[model samples]
Target: MAAVRTNGERTVNRLAIVSVLIITMIFLAPIYWIASTAFKPRNLATTIPPTIVFTPEISPFVKLFTKRSQLRAPPSQEEYEAAPWWERLVFDGGEKVVRSGRGEVQLSGYPSRFMNSLIVAITSTVLAVGMGTFTAYGFSRFKVKGEDDLLFFILSTRMLPPVVVAIPMFLMYRAVGLNDTHLGLIILYTAFNLSFAVWLMKGFIDEIPKEYEEAALVDGYTRMQAFFKIVLPEAATGIAATAVFCFITAWNEYAFALIMTNRRAQTAPPFIPSQVGSGLPDWTVIASGTLLFLLPVAIFTFLLRNHLLRGMSFGAIRK
Candidate 1:
């Protein structure tokens, strides 16, 4: 009887492992395709069978870096001499025609867009998490009137279709003369991400024992000090997970970014779509860009998988 039960458990464990592997592949397949496409030549990217593997070409990366270096170099007398022709045709032609002693590829406009995204995402994540953490602490520690109702209201804000809010936000930014500014987009992202950050952090904070904070207080620490010195350290895992979530949400945000800023502050998502010319987009460029975007998120999640799992579980018991 014991042997029969042991065999049954082993079979169940094997089935569970197989199921997990299948689900993981399903989630990772698109990312794999994106990374694969990035390295492929433009011609090979669109093949019918869809090439799953290839040796990476360095041209795309070379093109990306070379362009960036040129953008940073100071203008020269020769560059000034061509100003008229440069003005007539635009800097686009001037940069290509005018060359330094050594040959270098011009930096693509995509990197500037990438920089804009990085700035907006990092700033938004920091602000959102900072505000959300304190708010979550308040909700967890101090019982306020209709707290559950308030929490529901906060969560419901996230449900409001981004499209619905976008038009008004666009108009507001235009009115304030912030339409294309990084600050404008940072504020928008913070507002959009705040609800999830607050809710997630609140769950984690609630699970922590109040006794720890009380002990700190008894030892002469003020409430604020106790929070920073005691509770915050224990909640480090949850905060890290929350920061990643906030960063990714801001990084991948497109609709608002597209409408809010044009050339000056465009992000990768809009930039990717714009690469499409006439009939077909440059598949290789698109693939490469997609891979670049996914790589950071993948590395981050993999490094913090254990903490992420615990944070996401919100202290739920598996057994």
Candidate 2:
């Protein structure tokens, strides 16, 4: 009987491992496809059947930085038909291209757009976290008559779809001369991220014992001083997690960034898709851009992983 039970436990463990492996593959498949596409040339990229194994080339990577005038256009039907049979077998029609004048050309304005995204994300995260932390601190410590109701009201702002309010916000931004500007995006993202930050910080603040603040008070600390010196320190893990979430949201936001800014403030989300190399919708450029675009979030997450883990584990251990 004991042997049978042990066998059953081993079977369950094996099943669990298999399940995890399947899920991991499901998540990893897209990333692998994108990375593979990035390394492949246009010939492999636009293949109708989607080539699995092929020689990798850096032409697509180089084309990403070249100017439109400097880049080669798609091959014409005549040009496609004229290719040698052996070359034609491996090279698809879409892969044909050359520099505009057979001369060098400079890359596009990805750096500027990247900088714009960075500014908007960092500024918005800081404002959202700062304002939300203050408001959450107030809500956590104070006993208002309708505290729960007010908290619900604050949360209700996020329940509405962003599209529902886009028009109104756009009009308001234009009237106030805030449209197509960095400050405009910063303010908009901060307001959108505020609700989540407040809710997360409030829960974090509530975890601390009131005795700590009272002890500080007894030692001649002012209310504000105790909050800054005592409560804030304990809430650092939660604050880091909240800031990461806000940063990612603002960093990846597209619809708002697209509509709000036309040229000066466009981010990678909108800008990367429109980049054309050999033809319309350059797959290589798109894949390469996407791979690069993912780096900031990856780096930010790595940096704050410790805080995030602590914040996540806090609730489990608190009781």
Candidate 3:
């Protein structure tokens, strides 16, 4: 009987492992496809059977960052041999890099658009999370008038899809001459994320003991000092989790970014798809842009993975 029980346990464990592996593969497949396509040569990107294996090329990434035009004619043998490796990749793809008169390469808009995404996403995330932490600390540690009602009101903002407000928001942004500025998107994302940040942070703050702050006060620390010294440290896990969520929201934001900003402050989310030129769209370039776009959020989350794990389970159990 004991031997049979052990066998059953082993069977269950094996099944669990198999289930997890299957789920992981399912989730990772599209990401793998994108990464693979990003390195595929241009002609192989959209093949009927989907080429899974090929000689990887960095040309797509190069083309993604450079302005290029169709080659009028094949490069002379000397020209081909003399060109730099990246320029050779472009030349092989039947396109020539657009160059300035002084012989400098003219870059595409992707790099600036990528930078705009970083600036807006990172800045707004910080603002939202910072402001939310303070507001949440107040709610968690102090008595406020109509606290429940106020909390409900704050959460209400998230109940509606933000895109629903796109039209009015666009009009307002235009009226203020903020239609294509980084600050405008920053403010919008910060506001959109604030309610969520506050609520999430409040939970984490509530989990912390007020006794720590009281002890700090007894030690001659002011409320601000106690908050910075005691409460903030205890709530670090929650803050990391909230920051990740807020950053991703701001990073992947599309409709608002599309309508709110044009050339000056356009983010990667809106700019990547618009890379389709006059001919058949270059899927390789698009894929490369998308793969690069995925990196910042992935890295941010990976760095905070420990905190995120703890944050998710932080308040789930009580002594």
Candidate 4:
């Protein structure tokens, strides 16, 4: 009977592993496709039937630095032979001009766009997470009238999709001179990220025993003093976790950024689509740009993963 039970448990564990692997692949497929597409040359990028296995080329990677246009037709054999060594690898202009016949082609602005996203995301995370800590603490510790209603109202903001408010918000931002500004995006992202942040922090604060703060009060610490020295330390894990979510939300936000900012304030999200030229969008450049964009966020998440894990575990624990 014991052997039968052990075999059954092993079977269950194997099934769980299989299920997790399937789900992981489902989530990662698009990311893998994007990375793959980013490495292909223009011709093979959007090929019909989708080339799952094909020769890899360096042309797409080269275009990451310079803007290049598509040709009316493939280059002739003689043109391919006469091409400069570097051009052969990237443009291979051949018969048709590899570059746009129009005026000067400029280098891509991905670096600046990446910086814009990084700055706005970090700023917004700080604002949102800081405000969340205060609001959650207030809700958990202090008595206030209509508290449930206030909490519900806060949560309601997240239910209405950002698309619904983009146009109205755009007009409002323009009138207020907040459009196309880093500060503007920071404030907007903070507002959008606040709902979840507040609730998350509130839960973490609630998990901490009130007795800890009460003891601090008896020892002559004021309510605020007790909060800072006692409650805040125990809640570090939760704060770190909430910060990760806030950062990720602000990092990936697109609708508001696209409608509300341009030029000086534009972020990586909107600028990625702009990489494609007048013709069919170059999958390679777009892919390469996207890969570059994915790296910073990945690095950030990696750095904070330990704190995130602790917070998650603590949040799951209950009295």
Best by TM-score: 3
Provide the TM-score for each candidate, comma-separated: 0.78, 0.80, 0.90, 0.77
Ten-residue segment with the worst summed lDDT in candidate 4? 91-100
Roughly what TM-score does model 1 have, to 2 decimal places? 0.78
Model 4 ranges off by over 4 Å: 1-23, 54-59, 68-106, 276-278, 297-319
Lowest lDDT sum, 10 consecutive residues, model 2, at 89-98
lDDT of 4 by residue, 1-319 (tens): 2443677798987898999999999998999998888777677878788878877776665677665555666767887787666556654632222355474445557767888999999999999889989999999989979999998888788667888877787888889998999998998898887877887888888889999999999999999899899999998978887898888878888888888888889999988877565966768778888887887678867876655654434334433
Candidate 3 structure quality by residue, lDDT tens digits, 263-307: 999998889877775778889899999999998778977886655
lDDT of 2 by residue, 40-91 (tens): 8765787889888988766555555544432155556676687545333323
Better of 2 and 3 by TM-score: 3
* Sequence-dependent TM-score of model 4: 0.77
Residue 111 in model 2: shift from native, Å?
2.0
Residue 44, model 1: lDDT of: 72
Evaluation by TM-score, superior candidate among 2 and 4: 2
Q: Rank the candidates by lDDT, best first.
A: 3, 4, 2, 1
- Which number leads on lDDT? 3
Q: Residue by residue across 1-319, what tens digits does model 1's lDDT show?
A: 2443677798987898999999999998887777777666555778888776677664444333334222344457676565554222223322232334684334577778889989999999999999999999999999889998998898888778888989999898899998889999999999988987888888778878999999989999999999999889998877888888889889989988889888887887777677775886657666766777767778887876765654454324321
lDDT of 3 at 13: 79
Provide the overall lDDT of each model, using Cα atoms, as 2-decimal numbers: 0.76, 0.77, 0.88, 0.79
Clashing pairs in 1: 38-288, 67-106, 67-107, 68-107
lDDT at position 31, candidate 2? 86
Q: What local lDDT does model 4 show for residue 253? A: 88
